[model samples]
Target: MITIWGRLNSHNVKKVAWAAIEMGIEHRRIDMGGAFGFTDDYLAMNPNRLIPTIEDDSVPGGFSLWESNAILRYLADAHAPHLRPEAPAERAQGDKWMDWQFTFAEAQRTAFQGIVRQGKDVNDPQVSASIAATIKLAERFDAALGQTPFLAGKAFGIADIPMGVYAYTFFTLPFERPSLPNMEDWYAGLTARPGYASQVMIPLS
Candidate 1:
């Protein structure tokens, strides 16, 4: 069994937990970080002090891993081949979008932190600037989605997990956003998945 340590409300944690459920992996998630705080053992496992660390006892000597995207790749490569594209080139497509999510997140960080975490006014300069930057990045994502049904191509794969997590926040933010039909449609499909609904589609906190 895999032991995942992180609070459920964390986007990174949600990615790992949701992927585990989608892949039918037997694992248990323990709430840690945020208000729950972290233990010395947790810090030892992830020296960076980040949420969503995983320990897989199934590995030869017990393996602990960090980094949300890396963890997603490991889980897909090790346990769920279906989640990964078979061809190297095809797989790289998914890899690209996975990496892009960090950039996307960074672009929206100020707004998300201000509005979601601190409850700052949406019209605040920094918040509005961040939201504008996020919209520009999201437009690029929308264009990509317009060309392909999924980020990686025709089928939903690991590429969708990170962005799907963010999409909830993007769509739910209390501001006017230009409509992107492709992204909206893709997000709609994600909402229908039991794993996504249970894990990603939650009250933002």
Candidate 2:
């Protein structure tokens, strides 16, 4: 069985856990990190000491993987081929959005940390600036969704996973957001999936 180590509330852990469920892969998730506290045992598996590390004993040599996106790509390539496009060119489209989500998260750190973490009010200048920046990127995502039903094309793939996690946080926050029909529609579809609803659509901490 695949063993996953991370707290459920973590966005990164949700990516791996969500993919495993979607692929119908049996996994044992050991809660660690956050308030659970990291141990030396966990450190050996991932020197970086991050959440969402996976130990795949099914592999020939036994494998440990880190980085949420890397784990998603690995799970898709190994167990769920449908989650990734078959052709290289087609797969690159999914890769593009996956990478873009990382960039998006970094860009959103200011706002996320301020509003979500620090519990800043709307009047705070830092919160205001961060919100503006985040909305600007959301507009870009909306424009992209207008052209394709999914980030990777017509079908849902790994590309949609990360953003789906973030969308929950974005929409849940008490902020005035501009209406983006296409993005909202795509998110609605994601919410309809049991895997997404159980994993990605959880209450953000």
Candidate 3:
């Protein structure tokens, strides 16, 4: 059996769970690393002390693993390699979008929380700078999506998985968002996916 350890509320954890569902990888999920708190046995599973650690007993070598993105890659290549992309150029392009999500969208989230989630006025010079960054990043992505339906190209794939989860945070943030028609449209389509809705889109706490 495959055992997954993580708080379901975590976005990174959600990504892995979402992929598992899409690929139909049956596994048991354990509650830990949040309100459950970590125990020594949990430490045995992941020294990093992060949510989203998994132990797989069914694989050839039978090992455990951590790191959400790596888990996504593993599951994709193992069961749904089509989503992972076989062509070198397509894979490289997919890698770029994945990196862009972390480098651009995820990085700006701290600012999003400060101004949007915390319900502070986003007009202060510092807040404006941060919001501006988000807007600029969104625009860049809008331009990209204007060309392709998914970050990895026409097909929804591994790269879209991470980026799609990040969009949930953007949609839920409490502030006036810049015009991002393409992004909004893409996110809407993402919401239509059963995997996305099942693993993400729970009520915000």
Candidate 4:
């Protein structure tokens, strides 16, 4: 069985676990990050000291992987290549949005931290600015979803997982959010998926 190390509350870790569940991969998860501290052995596998590291004993030499997206790709390549686009150009279309989440997160992080973690003054100039930027990012996603049924086009794939996790936090937050019908519909579709509902749609802690 594959071994996964991370806390369920982590968004990055949720992505990995969601993928594993969606693919019906047999694995065991260890509660390891955040309040659950990592051991010295954990540090050896991932020097970055991040959550959601995985050990796949099935691979030659017993592969250990770090980085949630890398783990997503590895699982797809190893078990379900159908989860990714077959053509290079099509794959790139999916890749662009998957890569875009980090940049999007940088814009959204301050407001999320302020609103969810610290309960900072929502009207603070910095917080308001961050919220505006995050809305703009969502508008971009809304526009993209208008064209394709999924981020990777017609089919659900790795591209959807990152934003899928973010959408839960974004929509449920108490902040005033602009209504993007297309984005809402897309998110509704995600909520219907068993993997997304159980793994990605948990209460953001």
Candidate 5:
């Protein structure tokens, strides 16, 4: 059996859960983080005190793992090997998009947190910064999509999961977002994926 910890609304949790759906990995979930209280047992599992820790009793090396991307990569490396890559060149392409999400997509949302999540107005300087950064990144996103139907190209893969989860916040979050056709098209395509709708496209907190 596999157990996943964290709120379904959490972006990080969505990554692992969505990946599991993509890979057809059966798992259960525990409500934790946010309004749900953390427990001593969870701490014992992941001292970093983060949501989205995973426990797969059947995996060879261990029962649990933390860090959502690592969990996604691990699952991809295991059951959905085609979703990831064994060769260096293909792996490098995947890494590029993952790195871009961490560096570009994640950073562009800082103001979004300071504004919307904290209940502050969009005009707040931090909010403005977030929008500005997002506008710039939206162009980048458009360019990326222009080249590939998916981030790592053609078919959906591990490289698409992390940022794909993050992308939801941008579109659903209450705020004005500049129009970028490429990003919107890419998101629409992701929305059509079986696992994405089931596991990733849920109501936000």
Candidate 6:
């Protein structure tokens, strides 16, 4: 069995947990970040002090991994090869989007923190600016989705996991957003998945 250490509310953590569930991997999760605080041992495993670190005892000597996207790749490689495509070119279609999610996150960070964490008004200049910037970046996803049903091509894969986690926050934020029909359709399909519905589509923290 593998041990996943992180709180459910964390978007990064959610990616790990949701992938584990989607791939039918046997694992246990412990809330360790945010209000739960981190232990020295946790820091030893991930000096970066981030959430969603995993320790897989299934390996001969045991293996510890960090970085949410890296963990998703590892999980796909080790336990669920089907989650990722085998052909390099086919896989890159999804791989690029995995990295792109970080950009999307950065674009929205200010708005997310201001409104969700700081309880600032949407009209706050900085918050509004961040939201606008985030929306602009989202157009890329909208355009990509228009060509493929999923970011990872015609099917959902590792690539979809990262953005799927963020889409919940983007759509739920208390602000009007320009219509992105393709993204909306993709998000609706995500909600239909049991793993996404249970893990990613939760009350935002």
Per-residue CA lDDT of model 2 for 20-63, tens digit only, reads 88889999999999899889989998888789899998899999
Q: Per-residue CA lDDT of candidate 1, range 21-83, in tens?
A: 999999999999999998998998898878899999889999999999999999998999888
Q: What lDDT does each candidate get?
A: 0.91, 0.86, 0.80, 0.88, 0.80, 0.91
Model 2 weakest lDDT span, ten residues long: 103-112
lDDT of 6 by residue, 100-165 (tens): 999999988888899989999999999999999999988878998999898667777888999999
Scored by lDDT, model 5 comes in at 0.80
Please give the distance, in angstroms, between residue 52's alpha carbon in candidate 1 and its true position after superposition: 1.1
Write model 5 residue lDDT over 50-84, tens digit each, in one string: 88898987867767889887888888877789998
Candidates 1 and 5: which is better by lDDT?
1
Q: List the residue pairs that clash in candidate 5.
A: none
lDDT of 4 at 197: 88
TM-score quality measure for candidate 6: 0.97
Candidate 1 stretches greater than 4 Å from native: none
Give one digit per residue, the lDDT tens place, for model 4 in 53-156.
99998888898999988888889889778899989887888889888988787887888788878878779787888889989999989999999989888899
